[model samples]
Target: MDTEAVNNARHGLRLLLVTLLLTSIGFFIYYVYRQALPKPLPGIPCDEVAAKKVLGSLPSMFSHWKQHGVVMPWLTGHNLKHNPPLVQFFGAPFAQPTVILSDFQESQDILLRRGKECDRADRTLQSFEGMIPHHHLAMRTNGPRFKGNKELVRYLMSPKFLHEASAVQIYEKSLALIDLWSLKVKTSGGKPFPARQDIFDAALDMVSGAAFGFKDDLSITKRQLNHFLSNGVKFKEHENGSVDFHGFLFFGYIVAGHETTSSSLSWALKFIADHQTEQDKLRQALWEAFPDAAAEKRVPNVKITTTHVPYLDGIIDECMRLETSQTKITVGSWSVDDMHLFKPERWLKTGDSGELVYDS
Candidate 1:
């Protein structure tokens, strides 16, 4: 090559290298500055492991479960010690802050009284977008749109509507589930088998029966998208491309209903399995409540009058109490009962003030 041409090429290469080096240095300095920036608020900092982002903390900011599935209640059990309404921060840089409300009255005022002042976060809605990308109850924060969506669901869930459209479906599905479980247990030779899938399948069947009348596929149709509650509840951006708004909402119920119930049942089963005496008590309560519905045999015609069954009620409540700890929110349990037994009578007791001191 000619001398001038070679010289020019070398100069260009040096310039490019210098540019890249300067850019790298600038990025590093910017990252350091962001890390040094003051947190969103002064609170008890946690999860120093989370990534730094404007959309920090992801799911933990909404509740207790972090990106790595760690429940952040390492800050728990300090209710009387720390005097909550304590603020705790999670994540890095643009950290998501959480307030732990240990007081009942304060919680009531914030959750029930001043609900309008506190709107749901956007990223939380966005998290559900993969299931219900378009507008649905989970995605809506506030305003008339959220109101209409909730009202429609509330009406559909009303006793009258449920009795007419859904009760029969639930009953039949449940009976069929009992049969399936009977066969499963028999095949297991009375050994413990994984019940998660069975429970999940049953949930899927029940929710599908109620929501879509047993239609399996939920691919979107234009007609479905034009429904009144069809809009996008975006978190950061609309990079999710396109989805039929109506089908999004409908399918969301199918997925979420199954997930929530199945997860709850799994947790309940674990707790119950650990407490065999309570499980026996529950079985006794069940048989007494429905003489026709047997475990090994086909359960015929369960009366659904379970509200009158005390032991069963207690077992269910206790299961939920333990299961909620998985959510990792720090809160106290206030009940007058022997904490050991799966006793339901503890739920019925009154405190010294002649009032029930129920704590969530």
Candidate 2:
């Protein structure tokens, strides 16, 4: 071929490649933008009229925010007052109805009893990509595929694994957290303050160590584990969402360890902060569990386990309970007489032998 003809061909190929690249970037940008924001599936049977009155639009997003204000209170304070338990609809001509499960048994039946009903809507299949390839447990439909994922999770979470991993990574991170918080608390003159990001970072470190081996650059674990563990830490539980990056777009949700471990840590800290007694108990438990926890020039060398400190376990349980509105969404108008109230002590009761009751 002639030199001019070859040059022209090269130019054309380069131009084509540039066009494809630009188009790809544009598409990806739009996809990510759309994912982070909740959009209305207009035809979904929600109450559009009331939504408009509250938010001034048909496609209103009744997102989770301060689970207390947006959901729990509304469920207990408003919806429960209705005979059939009220539900709200979103969007116009075609609206999506929000199904509030006020009855715990009914929710359990739909989510746990009726297996197929619990499967992720097929619409979610598209979200299986990146670090979580299609076969990832979280992305699978409920059945054999999910079972395989469960088995994998079971192995990863075997007591031997968690206990070993906790000894190597988790407790180390916990100690690092103590140092970070000590400085922060000192800086704030020991006043109540926000430690969400720090907690997220600590959780992220543990998650990264769990998923990927520990890095010499420790904070990278915090950065990547943020995908699996923590996201939107600044947002209240109801308004909460994932913290995945653009590359993790398709892997919408993650299992830092189990379900929402990283975010749960933040909630745990928030709960502890709210209850000084619980916080003090936790501190005392920690000191007891690791006498060298505050030792200078040496990280506490302790093989810690939750069993050693019952109060610490109770604090975690209380944190999870209060997060129901944040995570579970209460339709408690059915069973729980008072779902909005936070009372962690109910989980504790003296047994006939004078031992504290423990039930899963």
Best by lDDT: 1
Error of 2 at 200 (Å): 2.1
What's model 2's lDDT at 352?
A: 90
Model 1 / residue 332 / CA error / Å:
11
Per-residue lDDT tens digits for candidate 2, residues 1-360, read 699999999999999999999999999987765443334444433334444342323222344334333444544433444445434433233323344545444655566456565666443454444355534533655455666654555656578877776457777677666755565466567787666666656676666665555553554323333432344223222222344333231222234342376668777666776778767766776676666665553555645653455555556666766664344432222226755544554555667998655333
Off by over 4 Å in 1: 1-28, 31-41, 47-114, 129-134, 138-141, 215-249, 292-298, 305-307, 325-333, 336-342, 349-360
TM-scores for candidates 1 onward, in order? 0.60, 0.59
Each prediction's number of clashing residue pairs = 0, 18
Give lDDT tens digits, candidate 1, residues 1-360: 699999999999999999999999999998877765435454553344333444455444445444434444534532334554554444445434555665443554565556578655566676776666555645545655776665545665577757765666667666555655555466557877556665665665666677766532331111122221243221111121243435755676665566776777788878888888878877877776666556545554534632356566566666655564333223335554655445554554555887433323
Ten residues in sequence with the least summed lDDT for candidate 1: 219-228
Local accuracy by lDDT, each model? 0.56, 0.53
State the displacement of the C-alpha of residue 208, model 2, in Å, after optimal TM-score superposition.
Answer: 0.7
Off by over 4 Å in 2: 1-59, 62-86, 91-109, 129-131, 138-144, 220-259, 281-302, 325-341, 351-353
